[model samples]
Target chain A: MQQPIAILDSGVGGLTVAKEVMRQLPREKIIYFGDTARTPYGPRPAQEVIRFTQEIVDYLLKFSPKMIVIACNTATAFALETIRSRVSIPVIGVVHPGARAAINRTQSGYIGVIGTEGTVNSGAYEQALKQLSPHVDVVSVACPRFVPLVERGNFRSEETYNTVNESLAGLRSTRIDTLILGCTHYPFLAETISDVMGGQIALISSAEETARDISTILHDKGKLARGDLLPVHQFCCSGDPQMFKMIAQQWLNEQIELTPIVWQVPHIG
Target chain B: MQQPIAILDSGVGGLTVAKEVMRQLPREKIIYFGDTARTPYGPRPAQEVIRFTQEIVDYLLKFSPKMIVIACNTATAFALETIRSRVSIPVIGVVHPGARAAINRTQSGYIGVIGTEGTVNSGAYEQALKQLSPHVDVVSVACPRFVPLVERGNFRSEETYNTVNESLAGLRSTRIDTLILGCTHYPFLAETISDVMGGQIALISSAEETARDISTILHDKGKLARGDLLPVHQFCCSGDPQMFKMIAQQWLNEQIELTPIVWQVPHIG
Candidate 1:
């Protein structure tokens, strides 16, 4: 059996990425890890996020993944470059692909980005966008409540709608024709967010682009799983395996056994 | 010195992909080969095309490219998977990325594809689109005159306009909202083609997408050129180096040396 593509995230938000991966690359198996015990990596310092990401990657390397996807926007913002340097296998992150998609989709050259505070504040999307399109304007805002609402699975509530509307109110005045749902969790609330932004605005989700990037890299590297063998997929989390399992089953419509991960937290001085 | 990204095409058509690669990844040093001696590999037998592509790829391997880009649609249609398996470095092709971009841009699920006979007949775009979005309808047309016009540098004449309009006449009735310029040579005819298809239709060129894929692969492989040193880009042709040099200088607005390749034509039994 081929080594599964490994994915890690702060929590269930990355299940958005995982879902797309399963949909797009059905022949390939996945091994996912969610740091649910340390959910909301948005509020953490960059250094801590890097350390946590490194720990998760170290654990994933043991499984011998053909590639690793940093599915967390916050962790990707802080740790992608570092983890890529440390790993031999291909490592992918959501931010650059998201920015590239947004750059491609935007007509007015006015692009808006919304993510966790860590992702927005980190200016990763802005840097990526500028790198792709030098003159385009990048407007980023932090939807601080969106991830929490998704984590609690309160995506369709009126409360979620109101929070989305209130959080995105500042963008209505700007001529931003393309909005990047920069956080993986935000696509779960795509309907409410789309309603707030109106039909003219294009919403760029990194999940699909990231999945496509994975396929390109795999095909290029000759790492694509060959033959029609029944493949096995794994799901694990550092905290609350049951919650992750429930979400995985619901999203994937398959019963998956999830193992709880308990890595020794290294003391970071 | 960083290993150059190697790009091969049947003729100057792949110059389009090379131009975009130079634009998008300025730090990248590119080694390009145009098989001008066998300019139109379109309509040729698949095995012959593959043999010709392998010959060119064998020539490129001497440069130690960090990656190989099959910049010609016909070559990619005929030989990408074969070359990929034979090489250890990343081998990228234009068709898949072009298909991906078309899938992303087509809102009506009705996509039009225009390419050389080999590319159109290969049904590579249709397969790629169906793999990504199983329901989308793909309409492909072969424009035999277009490549010769580009080769002859006849991009803006009234005859060229009439040729593009007549060539794409069949697509006007298909209600296809997105068009994939499947051949790398087609983008040079973008203005005339866009005018023929009208302003509403989105044209997808594999050049920029292929370039992005290169950048993504390089970054993932940890082989992206590190220093800010001025990169030396090489251009070579199996046919007329002088004509290729003139076009290259005009298109890129930079003086460049064109090397004429003389490979012992392998005896095909």
Candidate 2:
């Protein structure tokens, strides 16, 4: 059961979640597959996402993974249930972890969730929050383009910060003390998100929580690659190798030998 | 000889240029193509961009445009020479026009250029400016993800603004009297960029210059569409239609119906 952990995304947005998982589980090797070919499950119809997620999970299963993490917020919302039910190994979704973090961090009992349209629409966050603390008020805003923004590595520009400010204006007025960056790619914008929200609000990222969940599941299953050595991480993207490499360096803050992996995406649900 | 004009980009960044071209050339119809499936060509390698640009140009050629506008800064920098030389119709790059605007707008000798990494790496602005006036001190910085930041409609985030502040800190400290929004998508962040540079430094966008160039070229070639009614604008992309539509609406500030145009992007150069 020492097979590599398989994590898949529609694009590089999921790398944040995968990177955290890699950090927590240093003994295990991670096989990160970014389907940069047809990304952005945020705005697509639910059925299409279900089909796309199933295809990638099915593709990753060929690597004989010990466990799978749906790091993408949209896919986690749309396809997590189906994938978890069908897969033999443990399947983890990011939404619950994000919800738990928000509930823990919020002292005011008000939490804000900002993510892609599909993620916000799925009500996954709301449902998770309510189940954890039925008294907590949840606010969700869909920022469909944030993933591409972070993936493009534009987090440093005045325009990017301004966009973050403008994008969060609606959420700011809500007076939520804790804001959950519900999408994995969004952690890249934490600095800007925090600056806009100022000291009054907390910006919660699911990266660490998701990582913990991965460890818990793998430990329980006797699949933990227990070791002290730093794990070798492989990043594969279907988009331009150079662009992927540059973003991989900036966002991941480390050099990665990015290889192109060609997997025939099966059109199945 | 009257025919539609073709404008192609990796994404909706080109629309600012197209919008300006529309203002100046009211009678001409535009065949606008956004390769949102592979948007944000800034960080990609030149070779891959050439391939992507070539494929999109080939697709746009099916409409038989009288001329083409490489409205994307990254594309203009990397593929202009190859694309212009290969295509039968005239090809206009945004660099020359943007550089011209930067020179014209600067009251002081110091001017700054901000765009995608590919554009900054091509040294297109420095070369163009030196050609125009060697004495002008041009400071160039690569705001790699600004376009995608804009595309994601994250236009007013404080974090996005802070990133802008940090990325441009080098250029702004040099006491740049003027800055060029070298990429078409940058204008959407004009307010943020302007604020970061302080109220003193003037900012220039290439959109107007490109529009004027299109007008001059069309008028000179005797291919200007002459009719009381404006020409129809068609939008196309290589990626998810729903998300692309989200970007188009947010950027264009209007609803749009985009047709999916599948492309095989072998490489960029």
Each prediction's DockQ against the real complex: 0.26, 0.01
Candidate 2, B1-269: lDDT as tens digits: 34788998888788888776654455677888887767779889999998888888987898899889998988988998898779888888788766655654465768888988988999998977664444578889999868878767788899789878888888856978888888888988889898888888887787766765565445334465656564567788776767777877766666676654344433322
Off by over 4 Å in 2: A263-269, B1-269
RMSD list, candidates in order: 5.0, 26.9
Could you give candidate 2's per-residue lDDT for residues A40-121 as a string of tens digits? 7788999998888888887888879888889888899899889988988878878876775566457788899999999999
| TM-score of chain B taken alone, every candidate | 0.96, 0.93
Tens digit of per-residue lDDT, candidate 1, span A1-269: 58899999888888888887766666678999888788888988999999999988888887899999999899999999999889888889999888767765676989999999999999999977776556589889999889888777787899998999999999999989999999888888999999998999999888878887887788766677664565687888776667767776776688987764444434311
Model 1 chain A: worst 10 consecutive residues (lDDT sum): A260-269
User: Mind giving the per-residue lDDT tens digits that candidate 1 earns over B1-269?
Assistant: 58899999988888888888766666678999888878888889999999999998888898998889999999999899899889988898999888777765667889999999999999998877775555588999999899999888888899999999999999999989999999999998999999999999999999878887887777666676655665888888877767777777777789987753444434311
DockQ of 1: 0.26
Residue B32's lDDT within candidate 2 is 87
Candidate 2 lDDT score at position B148: 71
Best by lDDT: 1
